[model samples]
Target: MKSPQDWPEPIVRVQSLSDSGISTIPNKYVKPPIERPSLSNSFNNDINIPTIDFLGLFTSDGNNYANKSIIYEQISEACRNWGFFQVVNHGVPPELMDEAREVWREFFHHPMDVKQTYANTPKTYEGYGSRLGVEKGAILDWSDYYFLHYLPCSLKVHNKWPAFPLSLRKVIEEYSKQVVKFCGRLMKILSSNLGLKEDVLQNAFGGDRDIGACLRVNFYPKCPQPDLTLGLSPHSDPGGMTILLPDQHVAGLQVRRDGHWITVKPASHAFIVNIGDQIQVLSNAIYKSVEHRVIVNSAEERVSLAFFYNPKSDLLIEPVKELVTKQNPPLYPPRTFDEYRLYMRTKGPQGKSQLGESDKSQDEK
Candidate 1:
């Protein structure tokens, strides 16, 4: 009987893509870390991430569209005004978030020698990396992470998961399942708000074709000078939606709102959610994928789990015609996430993954 921690290692087999017979996965759009001249006196240290009470948003004691009315209002505000919000009572249990974090810490805390076995290097983009903005001459961001592409379960190959946690596999597997459900529920809410059937967006994902999910477990090691380090660079997520669960009490997440950056204060039990590019296209760009970034602290390191929810690579993403009436013509042409991803890869690490403005600019004479 093979246990979760002691199962025989399975050889990772990946198809060769280039001249050299090595496996390659899609790498992230890298960007140089932005540096500030000094920890300024005027810079905002007072801002925080917006918080939304699910109970307040979905008032249970309502009828017919009552529940939806509350959700619609808050969702619209979060999307249009703030572009980000911390979601509580999201239906994903708090216990699950806790378990996922425990497993992540276990793997990260493994000795450097044990962790290095998964070193991604230049060949395979599937393993591990320290710091962001890895390109030469780019200022590095202060963060360490383990990246995994999970979905189509077969595609999931264990790299260097911790060997001691008894419930590691069960916990992660269950958590991933729950995330898929959360993504579905959110799509339906957005769809209804977009004047489409509840299933409009969900159907765009195709019947049980399995959505794409990319997970990054980040460990922000304590910095000697937190003012000099960034847990994550200022960038937009490149998927349909991003689900984040941060350290319980620490405050580091922030989103660019209005013209200012607002902090995303950590809540006791919540999953901070942010929309991404695919949804922007499907929703006619009305619900935007906001620009968000992270800041580090000088005292303690922060740990976060970011799950990127995306449609299948082959799905055609076009603005729903139903949402575009006489007043609102289709904002974007049909395109696939795969193509957008290719364009971004070639564009190099600018962190601007959205194509809305770029497409519009090209359309103009």
Candidate 2:
């Protein structure tokens, strides 16, 4: 039995595990005794999640007003109840989505050295790596990922970006532009649902040029003991919102609702949208930032692209004034993006949103 120190210096990528041709969970990959569990036993497949159609929202005819109102109501219900929903006709060209996935698949299949050239480090959030938090005895997840900061294009570090698979950069850049626009429009609808001006939420993010966004491409390979390990640890997103493009054929993402773990099935050309911790705080806790996790498959691999929309680093986040009155005071205190990120780095993902943890820590202090 080897300790975590004996593991590879840079940490082994999940793709390497798939390439080894081994059939059993390696000793190093086995989680701590206290953390191990039968993942198969926790699933509840009876509940059906909601899916929203965006095609009607973009129409220019006489029914547009009615369609927009209905769609806004549906989105509000989903956010308040489940904090998750799927959107079809989202306007991101299917061809571009397909090409983006193809390029990423090709990039991940490159030689280990090729991927390692852009390895992530403590100082930078971008690049390729595994086991983000390497604390001793920690239960590491079973996924490898490439992360890049997208919005505020000026903040992008050209050196940290991957230069392989040829078309990887081009496809991602174009896709990012489209997703950001779509997210902005979605924010407007959310703001209107909350009885605020159409641009209230978008404006709070520090205008179009100052907002921040990140793109994370995740790859989860088949695990020998799938029931004993997780593709990702259970946690809630710390940003404002997330637009996720999951593999159409594979399923592993799950959300916890009413103490039951429900699987999120993928729909053709649809993006899974979930409210994040910041959004919950901005809404004064009216909207939930639900806990979700990924389970590994034993026979097939899974991949997903997650776009995290956030506010500017210097922007202070707090409950919107309109949403906070005598009946509903602010649920979370004001905090900057930098402060929130530092808290998440220290606590890691542990089945709860960072905002909740931050509030608890403040109360205790």
Best candidate, lDDT: 2
Taking all chains together, the TM-score of candidate 1 against the true structure is 0.78
lDDT over C-alpha atoms for residue 256 of model 2: 68
Instruction: Superpose all Cα atoms of candidate 2 onto the true structure and report the RMSD in Å to 1 decimal.
Output: 4.5
Candidate with top TM-score is 2
lDDT of 2: 0.79
- Local distance difference test, each candidate: 0.64, 0.79
Candidate 1 Cα lDDT to native: 0.64
lDDT of 2 by residue, 8-64 (tens): 344777778877977877665676554444633355556656899988687688868
Separately for all candidates shown, the number of backbone clashes (residues 3 or more apart, or on different chains) is 6, 0
In candidate 1, the residue pairs with backbone N, CA or C atoms under 3 Å apart (3 or more residues apart, or in different chains) clash, namely: 30-349, 48-263, 48-264, 49-263, 49-264, 49-265
> Candidate 1: where are CA atoms >4 Å away?
1-50, 55-65, 121-124, 131-134, 158-164, 325-327, 342-353, 356-365
